[model samples]
Every structure is written in C-alpha cells, then in structure tokens.
Target: MLLKELSALASPLNDQQIGQLQKTVADLSPQQLAWISGYFWGLSQTPAAAGATPQPLAAAVATAAKPAGKLTIIYASQTGNAKGVAKSLEAAAQADGIEVSLYSADDYKPRDLAKETHLVIVASTNGEGEPPDNAISLHEFLQSKKAPKLDKLQYAVLGLGDSSYEFFCQTGKDFDTFLSKLGAKAITPRIDCDVDYEGDAERWRSDVLGKVKETIGGGASEVVVPLHAATSVGTASAYSKQNPYTAELVANQKITGRDSGKDVRHIEIDLGESGLTYQPGDALGVYYTNSPALADEILAKAGLTGDETVEVAGESLTLRQALIEKFEITASNPQQVAAFAELSGSKKLQKLAEDKDKLRQYANNTQVADVLGEKKTKLTAEQLVGLLRKLTPRLYSIASSQEEVGEEVHLTVGLVEFKNGDNTRVGGASGFLAQRAEESGEVKVFIEHNDNFKLPADDDAPVIMVGPGTGIAPFRAFLQERDARGAEGKNWLFFGDRTFTQDFLYQVEWQKYLKDGVLTEIDLAFSRDQAEKVYVQDKLLAKGQAVWQWLQDGAYLYICGDATRMAKDVHEALITVIEQHGGKSREDAENYLNELRKAKRYQKDVY
Candidate 1:
C-alpha cells in the first residue's frame, strides 16, 4: 500500500530507487523502518548531500571510505566493570570521529592481533593473577610461543581491580607486559584503578582518545552516529548505579533455623513502575548506608568529634555523615593500614607495615577502629577521612526468575557480622537489608547483567549446579526458569552447609522440585553431620563416575560460591575426576577442563 501510494504521487526517488527501497522496507519491522527514516534524515543533512562545502564526514568518505586508522578495543571483564569502561571508550571514540570497533575478549580472535594498528585492552583480574574466564584463550595465546611480533601496533591498557587483593590488576599487567614483549609500542602508560575508579578512568579515557585522534586522520565532529544505532535491539531501562530506582522492600524472612550459626534472609524487592527486568544469573546492586553506631565508634577511636566538617568528593559534610554514608569503615585494606601507620607514627603499626604478609593478615582480620586505636594520636577530620575508601554498592545474585515472579526480585542475603574486641561489627549493605531496613521501606537498586554466566541456550542440555550456602541464589532462578519453560534437560545439585536441619537453605523447595521431577538428582553435604567434615568437593569425588558420564554426555557445569577456597577445591576435584576416569594425565585433565571453559560448557560465578 505504501509503494502504491508512492507510485500514485510524485516522489524524490526514481522508479528503480523506489523498487529498491520497497525491497529493503519489506523485510524491516515497524521499529526498524522508523529508525531508518530518522537515519536517512541524518544522512541527508550531511554536507555532501546538502550541496555545501565538504566537511570532515565528506572528506573522510571521499579519501578512503573509512577512517585512516582503526582503534580496536577488547575487554576482558569478569563482573562487567571492564566491559562498561570499554563501552564508554567506544562511545567516546565514535564521538571524536575516530574509527573504533569493540569486541569481547572471548569473541575476538587472538590470531588477528597482528592486523590491528591501534589497540586498547580493558581487563579485570579474577582471583589471584588469573584472567577472567572469557579472556583465558586470548591471554594464553599471547603468552604462548605462537604469538606474533607487532612492531607496528600501538596500544594502552586499563586495569580495574581491588587493592584488597594481593595481585591487584594482575591480568591487565600481564596483557601490558605480553604486548610490550611482542614489540607493540605503548600509546600511554597503563593505569591500574582501584574500586573508586571513575575519576581516574575518565582522565585515562581523555588522554588515550586525544592521542588516538592525533594519530588518526579524523577531526572531532558535531554530527556523530546516534547511540541507538550502535546499541542492541532491545531497549533496556536506564536504571543504573548512577541513577538507581527507589524500590520497596517487599519482604525479609529468615531462611535458616534458630540453631544455625549463619543469619540468612530471603529478600524480596518490588520493582513496581521502574520497568526493571533481569535474568537468572544477573545481580542486583543495592546502595546502603553504614550503621550510625559504628560511625560514632570510629570517630571516638580517632579522638575526633562527630561535628567536625570534612570534604568528600568535593562535597562538604560533617565527619559523622561522611563516615556513615560516604566512606567505608567496616573492611580495612592493607593500603589504608599502611597509610594510617605513616600518619600515626606508632612503632607497632610501623613495624607491622614493614612486613607485607603480616600487614595483609592484620588488615583482613581488623577493622578501621582497631588500627586507629593503636595509638593515642588525635586526628583532624581530613586526616581521618583520608584513611578510608568510598562506600561502594553491594551486588547480590538474583534468586527468582521474572518468569516466576513478575515485577519482583528476590535475593538470598547472609548477614555479615564479626566480633572486634567486645563490639560486634556488621557489613554495611547486609546490616541495612537484614536489621535496619523494615518492610515497605525504600531501597535504591539496579540490575547488573552478567552475560558471561548464564544457562545454556539449548534448553535440552543437561546442567550440573554446585552452589553452597548463599550461592544457591542463581540456581533457584535457573530452576524456576527451566520449570516455566518446561525444559527437558536433566538437573543435578550439590549443596553443602554446616548442618542439615539448621543450615539447609530452601530445603522444602528443593524437595518439592525433586518430588515433581523438575530436579533429576540432589546431593547434600552437611559438614558437621558426620564424624569428619565433608564438603561439596567430597560429594563430587564420591560420584566421580556419574559426573564423568554426565560430562561425556554433554552437560554444562556451574559453580557459584567462595572463590578463595570452595571454587578452587571444586576445580581440582573435577580435574581429578577427569584424570582418574578418562585415564588422562594431570596436564591432560587440566587441558580438558580448559577446553570445556573455552567452549562455554563450564562456568562459574564465584566471588
């Protein structure tokens, strides 16, 4: 009908052009067609089409039909921070009229490294010095003997990590060193960012893009591509850390028995009119305030009154408010401890700071007040505030699928409480959610999408999930989604806790799933129920034959729990299973697991 109307009236295009336009529009949906109309208008406003003097766009197209040099950005992200920065760089580059392309480290072929002219790597280290799961292949290729020398390449690296870890930004450091060894020139010095990395990241982006603009033959342009043109097809809500949705706490029910040592709460939050939606493996980032009592205790230890004025991130506020709402006081890091030791000049702290191992141990076990009370020195507000990092939002895995509960999100939160002398310290976010927050109270939250950790696209593929304690959150969502979709895949769960009756989280729900045939198999490992302590790894070892059989039959494996110990132990257990059952050597077993990871058959969301 549109083509007939165009034929009936006078049009801008000739007969052949009209027919071609019709063919193109025939396959496009309404949204795509509307977007094309706006895009065509944008194209018409270009200088070449407007019969004006040639500008940068026209000149660029006339010269080579593309920009002079290519700026390729590859991001190796574990929990999405590095990916976010890489996307920002891509947008900035496009705005500067530079030819930029972005790819995840998983999708980018390492063999194509020699073809790049300008490159930027945004990576985050996993646990210790390991690269993220998606980056393992690329990282390994660059370090192997097969790597190519790239004397013509110029690049820079931006590393995002936490200072609390021993090997801060190790993956980025590895990439930088690997590229340097292959003769790639550094465009700028590598920047290793701590948790509060926004300011530094912005500066680094400016410097790197300025350098690229000087080298690439494209001037900054007022007419740039629309962000929607480069974005994904679906339109996601604009709720994020910077602009969070004010959600209401629907419920906070304890999931553990009274005799349990752990305090775990099953939380439900109402998304309401926020238009927020999330998948099973995604997390919800919650902004919280510290307990006022803990803030007062820290101020008292520093020998400073709560009324002292302090400046935080260009905002002036009382020291008490800053401690309670802005800075982190519950968890102390080695960097902060070292800095505080220098300020106080306490002989004990100064001696402790000299030993890195002991300093890290003390920082991990102690709190802010423990370090401040080491000396009788009185500190000004500025001096005391400088000892802490900014308070960051906490991320909890989503425990319910949108399929199961509309306009609502669920979480399994364990209250983080520890003893410091006679005082009991609680984590900022957990304390807020478990103790301070009342039913129907407001909480700021946003969805954090995790594409790296998700169920297999094939609904018929079997899945083996090992999630202990609160790690059981995403599995619940996965099971709910599978049940909703009526997936025919076999499901197996290996769960462990301290006691069976006291610590078994969501026991009735798991039993229901089993009885209903949604769950194929279930294994429980109550560490204290037997004479000796048993964990999930022990269960996996005991069922090594069946685990191997399932793997051979094409099963996806998932692990979500403590990265420091549980994940490592489970990983070693799987390697052993492959070694003992497949009659493979230790190295071969490790390589088999690596291949599985590269194939996306094995995934982990360990913290």
Candidate 2:
C-alpha cells in the first residue's frame, strides 16, 4: 500500500525496490534522509563494480576498479589533441576488460599519485617547452620540496608536440624524468610524437595497456563505462574531428584595414543543421585544399605528370589530386628538408642539411617548392610523397558563440603571407579561407572543445580579458555570450595592436557594447602611436593598482595572445603588479599567482 503511494512520480521501481527503500528509511529522521540522498547521489555519479571503489567528481575522470590494480590515464593538453588520444585509450582499455580512470592533469590531486598502481601520462608541450596550463600545478608539485617518493608507482609517458620546435617533447620528457627520479618504474620508454601523433600515440597506448594487463592481478569490470562515447552536453552530433561536417562558407570579409600590416578575415560558415553546438572558447577545425598553383609547381619541378597515380597512407590517388588535397606543399621543416636533400643528392643541399643550425634556418625560411626548384631531380610520385608530411587541418579560435550567432559559426582568421625569395607564400588554411575560396564554397569543419578555458560557472563573477592582435577572437565570443545571457558580471578588456586607427578590430561592436554598459572598461595600447612603444603590458602596469584590486575581488583573469614574448612579458607584469600593490615579497607574489592559477582565477589560451 505504501509502495503504491510512493510511485506518484511514475518511477519504474518495482514493489521489491520500493519495499527495500522504505525499510531502509522507515526508522530514519529527516537528517538521515538527507544523508541517504547524498550517499545515493554519489553512488549514482560514481558507478563501480560490486566490490570496487567508484571514482569521484564526474565519470569523465574516473571509473570503479578493483583495489589490487586500476589503470590511470592522465592527459595534459594545450589543445584537445592529447585529451582525445587519452580518451580513446581509456575507452579501448575499458573495452578490453581493464579497469581504468581518466583525468585532466589539473583535476587529479597530487596526493593520490603514490596510491596509483598503473599510470599513463599523455602530455602535450606548449610554446618553448612549457607545460600546458592545466599541468602547471602538478608539474611544480612534483618538482617541489614536499614531493613524495613513488617507489611503487609504474608509469609510462606519451608526449605530443611539433618537431619543428627545438624542444619537441620537453614537457613529457620532464614528467617521465621527474617520476623516474622519484623512484617510479617506467614500464615502457617515453615516445615523443610530432604533429602527426595519432599512429605513435596509438602504438604507445597499446603497449602500455598490454604491460598493465600482464602486471595487474585483478581483472577488469564486466560492465564498462562509456565516458567519451557521446557529447556531454546538448545533442551528440554525428560529425567530429575525424568525420567533419561539410559546412558552406557564407561570409569572408576583411575585418582589418587594408593599410594594416595584418590581414584578418571575419569569416562565417553555415552549419546547416549539423546540430554541432560549441562553447565560447572552443576552436573550429578547418580542412582546406592546398593551393593549385603551388601543387602544379611541385609537379613541374619534379618532372612528373599530374596524371600519375601515387600511394600514400595506403590510399591511391592521382598525383595532382594528392598534391592539392593530401600532401603538405607550402612549408618545409628540417626533417623534410634533410629527407629531400638526401634523395636529390645535391652536394650543396646535403652539406647545408648536415649542419643543424643552417638546416633549421634554411628550412624555416624556405618552402618545398624552393627545394624542388633548386635541384633538377627526376623523382617518382611515391618518392616525393615520402619526403613530405601529411596535410593537417588548422584550428582557429571561434569568434562567435552559438548563443549569439545561432547555426552559423564565425572565425577571425589571420592570414600568414610573406615573400619567400621571388615567390609569394601563404598559410594553407588562411590563404584558402581568405583568398582562394568563395562564399558559397563548402569547407570541411569540426569543433575542438576546450574545457580548460571557459567562463566561470558563476555568471555573476567578473572577467578580465587580455587579448591582443588576432587573439581577440575568443574574447569576442565571450563578450557576445555574456551579453546574450544578460550576465551582470563586469567585463574588463585590454586589447593592443600596432595602430588603433588601422588595426582596431570590431571597433563598432565594442563601442556599442560599451555604450550599452555590457562592457565595464576597455583599455587600448597602440604600440606605434607615440614616441615610446606601449604594449598591453604597459597598460597593465599603468593600471596595476586596479588590476590588483580586481584580483582581490575574485575576477577571472584571461590572456590570449602570442606565447613567445607578449605572454611572458605580461606574466612578469602581473607579478610586478601583485608585488607592488599587494605588497608582498617576489617569492610570495609568485606563490599568490600560482594559487590563483590553481583556483582557476588565471587562465590563458596562448599559442
């Protein structure tokens, strides 16, 4: 009778379950009921095997595993590449009956490091060998005085980075080294991967999983959790990075003035009911066709007909089509340059390639066409393809939120154009989006979601955005999103460029936003406007007192710009402001900022 009354909400629980629930709670008070509610909530959020401990937080991070052995998968990604690889590995391991947990480096507490039986770190190195933002705390913790010995820990590392950089996989190398120094066992050697990291990452994952399976005595759970199987929010789209949606280009207008040194386009693409929705800070991946003119030049220089069929990555296509759609023809790196030099047998080129410094300088300044144009070598299509890396899609920070733009996605694309000797060269994607393609033409695209960079969940929290040059892209989306949501959080922006008159992008909308009171304050730094070149950091120092006050008031500080110089300079400036206004020692100021980073008050999206 009581069971029948409890089914008022149309809960499908049978009489037995209802009776069990009633029996368990019949003698309990309201306090006990609340406690029981929370207990079951945790149980639901963390599902484990009958005897195992369910992981905490969300299902994305952990899975229930046997006490004896549980595999841990952790990723420190600047972009979504390493996270994607880690998730794929997590799903695979679960499918193979291996109990596993997946964690973003920031979320995984350092204290639990020693308790882990098996560990795999998939880390991506950011600009100049720096660890990704999420990994900063963990990386520093491991290197600090309070670091613990991991005598029983067995770990493996997979580093994702571009070989073009001097320290290709420095972050991952550091992690592996730190763990090893702390007495952790390395089950497998560290593998540093270049831009095309999929194959190597997969191989490393397989090897690590196999090693864990052999070492661990307890078996995996029969019922597995599928975390990455579907989109966490909204409707899961059929399209993804691997299988992208065919979106048509609707608009590609030059946002920057013609006189400006930069060529930035405000591009719009029609989603057309792809049902792919994205957050403000997410990136849009675009797969573009290479320049036809450049492709023709390569074929002519190689003395090959366009009709010749070539095999690449187990696919057969006409050489001309491959050059246009598949191969990377515009840029050449040291590896590509050295490989070409060896094949062509040019004595001068071989001599230059032998010298690392000269080769790097030569490769950075030249292109594949230049190499082919220099030497007269009769090469087969297959041989030529072997020398070049595959064409990878470019990712641009989205400039418009779906909340404001609806089905159309907007991007602020900065074209990379320069003179390479006698010929003009441009970035593959930028040139295609800005010059070669028409408005009605279709482009393959997908969303690269970033969880690390986001507006505070608390809509009332203030935001301080520092984005200069083309980095202003995502901040545009942020402001648009805040406006659409009617979020009362104060918005402060610091934007810089060469000249405000010619290079101030989205000036009209910002003015309107300011007039509408959506933006609380705006600061501009035109580097060439005065006798003394003033950048964003100078503006920061000038208003250092106010900036420090904002920090004390719990404002979220965000920076998106060039990582090499601007970010470093601004970081030092922030520290100086903290020390000057907050009145702390240099070391204390550093610690304060580190704490802010840990609290997610300071976030960056630098390349």
Candidate 3:
C-alpha cells in the first residue's frame, strides 16, 4: 500500500527507479527505513533550505552527474601481515570517500572479478613460493582456463616476503601475471617488499589512494567516516607492532636438561590491566635489543669505532647504539652479503654472491660479523650501517590460554646460538628472553592473531596434532582452552625431539593431563634414543590405521613445526596413510587432504 501510494504521488523517479527502490527497502528495518527517508529528503533540499550556508544549486547538480566506482581489495595471508595491509587500504579508501569492499581470498568469489572496476591484492608468499592455504582455491581458479576476462579492471598489487627466500613475493607476482593475462590494466607497478615492509607499504598505500581518487569521482567528504570511529564499540587495545606494551617478565625457566644440546626456556609474561586478549592460536611479538658485546664485535669486524655517528629513521645515534638498538646484526641475508661484496670489491665474495643457492647457504651459516670479516675492507660509518636491515620483532606461538591464565601469556622459546670461531653469536630476541630479561623486567610485546590456525568450534570433535620441537606451543594452548571449557573432545598429540629424557618438554604437564583424562592419547618419538632415527613421521606411519579411523570419524588435523623438512615429511606420511587405509589412489588421497583444508579441518602454524 505504501509503495502504491508512493507511486501515485507523482515522484521524479521513473518506473524502473521506483522498482529498484522498493526492492532495496523490502528487507530493511524500520530504523534503517527511517534513516533512508531522511537521507532522501536531505538530497532533495537546497543548502539554504537544509539550514546550512546558502550555496548555488549548480554545485549539487554537478555532484549528481558523476558516481564513483567501487574498489575491491583481496588479501592472501598466512601469518596476518598481508591482511593487515589490506585492511589499512580499505580504511584509507573509505576515509577518502571511495566506495570500497574488502574480502579474504577464500571468501571472495572468482566471478566477481569481472564486475570490479578497481582491484588491489596484498599477497604474502608461503612455504617455497606457494600460495597460502586459504588462497589456494582462488589462485587456482585465476590460473585455470575458465577464469573470466577482466579487460575493464584496473588493478595494483603489493607483495610481502623475506629477502632471504629465493622466490621472494612469488605469490604476488603470480597474481599480477594472472590478472594481466586476463587483460586487466595495471594502475601502478607492482611493489614487492621485504620483511621490513612497513615503510614501503605505507608509500604504496598513499600512491594507490591518490590514483584511485583521480580515476574515480572525488569529494564526498561529508559522508566519510573514520575506520576506528565506526568500529570503536568492542575494539581491541591500541597496542600494536608500532606501539607495543611494555609487559613484565613473570618467569623464565629452563625446560631442557642441563646435558642437552638445546637451551629452551618456558617464558611467562604479565599483561595486567592492558586489556590485551588473545585466543589459543595467536602469537606474541617480542622486541629485544642486541647485546653490547655483540654490537662491539660487529664494530670491531667492520673496522669502525663506536664513536662514529650514523643516522637511522631521521635520528642520529652512535654506530654502536644503532647496532644495538636499530639494526639486525645476528641474522645474515643474501642482499646484505651482495651489498657488502660490491662495497669491498672482493672477487671471492662477488663470485659467491653471483650464485643464488651458494649465497643463501653462506648467509644462513654465517653471522653479520663473519660476513664482514670475509673481506679486509674498512667501511665508513654510513657504509657499515647500510649493510644491515632494520631490526624486526620475533613472533612466538602463545603457549597458554587466557582462560587458564588470566592477564598473562606464555611462550616456548628455543635459544638460537652458534659459534663464530672463538666468539659465540645469539639470536637477539631469544637471548633476551632466556638470559638478559630478568624476572620483573619489562619486555615490549604485542599479539598477532592467526585465524588460519585455531581449534575446532565443536566441543566434541576429535583433534590430531603433530608438533616437533617448539611446534608444541599452540597445541598446549589448545588443550588448556579445551580443558577450561570442559570440552569432551578427544585429543591426540605426536611430539618428538632429539632424546626422550633430555628434550621431553612439559613432560609432567602432559602426564598430568593424561591422568586427568583431558588428553586421550600421546605419542613420543625421540630421534636419538635408538640406533635408527625415529621422528614424528615414523610415529604417524606406525599408527596409520588409527589415524585413518580418526579422519574417517571427522577429526581435524594440525601441523606446527619447521616448514622446510618436518612439515613436509609429516604431510607426505599423512598422504601415505590415507592412500593405504582409505582405499584410494595417491591423487585421490591428495585431493582428500585438499578438501579437508578447504573445509578448515587441516591447519598449520609453521615457520
């Protein structure tokens, strides 16, 4: 009746416009309808009549002539960095009065690409140049023959990865190539950023927003809303990588045996009153300064005095201070080696840098001081500072549930130490937590939430976890949450290390959980306990029948450990188990695992 009355009222809208308006408002709430009614009435009024300063109606007429195009942003992320960048882009675009939509690669439909006028992708490379698990479906669709042509699409891409990897930003390169082949025009050159990507990412965001404003009709600032302003109802704390919270170290106890080759610390940090909350699968990012002795050693190796001043982030500091607080000196990368080789004009170093494989090997095995010592060249203060990348925070998987330990977080940290001739090198963050950080000392920290790795939502669902070494961190959190919630789910853990007695981390806790009926089953594989090496993969194969039965009964599988060898070996072992017990071919088993991943039944948190 209202529609009929509105139609009979001699409205300016034609029949088609009226029909669209009716269709749009059919499902709207009374409050939404009231807001729309006011919006429409305001659009019909002149500036003077709306109680504003008088303005000519010609400006309003011109504003109605152009409608802005929509901007679509998709993120393919493994560890949340790419997603963060995409969210910033969306917020910036909205603040500029542009119509924008954001989607994870998994949630977005491939067919929508043809409808998008402007598209931006922020992708991070996973493993050895592979797309992230959530992005596999979309990545494959774009590469397939059935993908639609996007000739009218204007796009830009930003890639994030570590420069140490041979195939840095390979996933972003793939997306750029795939879209270009489908005839989409690139609005700007693709930017591939290394681990220290904040600066470059901010610049790219500015450039992209500027181009978008120019291409689309601009100046709807009246309707613009800030992202934080709109979402402040249940927003998180302001502490982030840029602005970290200085939390106190509650405890740092050694979990490994004294005779063991490894040094692992069970770290506990107090987050009292900070309102920083996290789930089971989240990671804690820790910022630590390098030791003075190590910084002095680097200065001695570079043939520079500690008194030389160098500039960092527009601030001048002594070379030693910069080394200790601003730059990464413990880990060596291929880019640093190549730069130093060219600066020193060393033929041996130059030849080593020419080969990608050898250069990566050399960088991985050598430290910054060792790399500098390869040549006898004396570099200036600026040159010495230029050879290193900025210090980045280390992320550790949170090992305790907030439900179990209120206002506190826990971590399993393995000390990274190696010998450089007579000198010993230690990882900046690990060494800080294990040795330098005293109980009650402050540590700058933030949480990194990873949705890709999480527990099953169903309380009764069974879970199988494979975590060797420090990979057991998140699983510990998972069990804690499950126990706290009184979940009836069955839990199985496959854990391994060098030796059973020396490296069985949290053995008493596991035993207690088993006795309390919280943990259903546990498997241990100590590689050096016997003559023949036995790992988690061996344990999985040994329990192949039961593993298959658990999968058949709707079990979720998780893997957390070293990505290079352990994760790959466990994956292949699972495939073999499936193929042998499920009566399927090798390809079918692989497809079954892929289906599980798509269904969020298979998850990984590997580094």
- What lDDT tens digits, residue by residue, belong to model 1 across residues 242-328? 778999998999999999999999999999988888888898999988888989888888888899988887899999999989988
- Overall lDDT per candidate, in order of appearance: 0.86, 0.83, 0.86
lDDT of 3 by residue, 1-607 (tens): 4875777888866676667666666665443344444444666585666576634333433333334577899999988888888887877776566667889999999988888999999999987788887798999899999899999999999999987877889999999999999999998999999988877987888788788877874444423322222221122887776678999998999999989999999999999878888999889999998888988888887788899988888999999999999999889999999999999898888999999999998888888888888888888888888888999999999999999999999999999987878878888889989888774398999888787898999999999999999999999999999999999989999999999889999999999999999999999999999999999999999999999999999999999989878988999999999999999999999999988988889998888
Q: What are the TM-scores, per candidate, against the unseen true structure? A: 0.88, 0.84, 0.88
Q: Model 2, 281-340: lDDT tens per residue?
A: 888989989988999999999999889998766889999999999878887888988887
- Candidate structures ordered by lDDT, highest first: 3, 1, 2
Error of 3 at 176 (Å): 1.1
Clashing pairs in 3: none
The local lDDT score (0 to 100) that residue 528 gets in candidate 2 is: 87
TM-score of candidate 1 versus the correct structure, residues matched by position: 0.88
Off by over 4 Å in 1: 1-61, 64-68, 221-235
Estimate the lDDT of model 1. 0.86
**Worst 10 contiguous positions by lDDT, candidate 3:** 226-235
TM-score, structure 2 vs. true? 0.84
Clashing pairs in 2: none
Stretches of model 3 off by over 4 angstroms after superposition: 1-68, 220-235
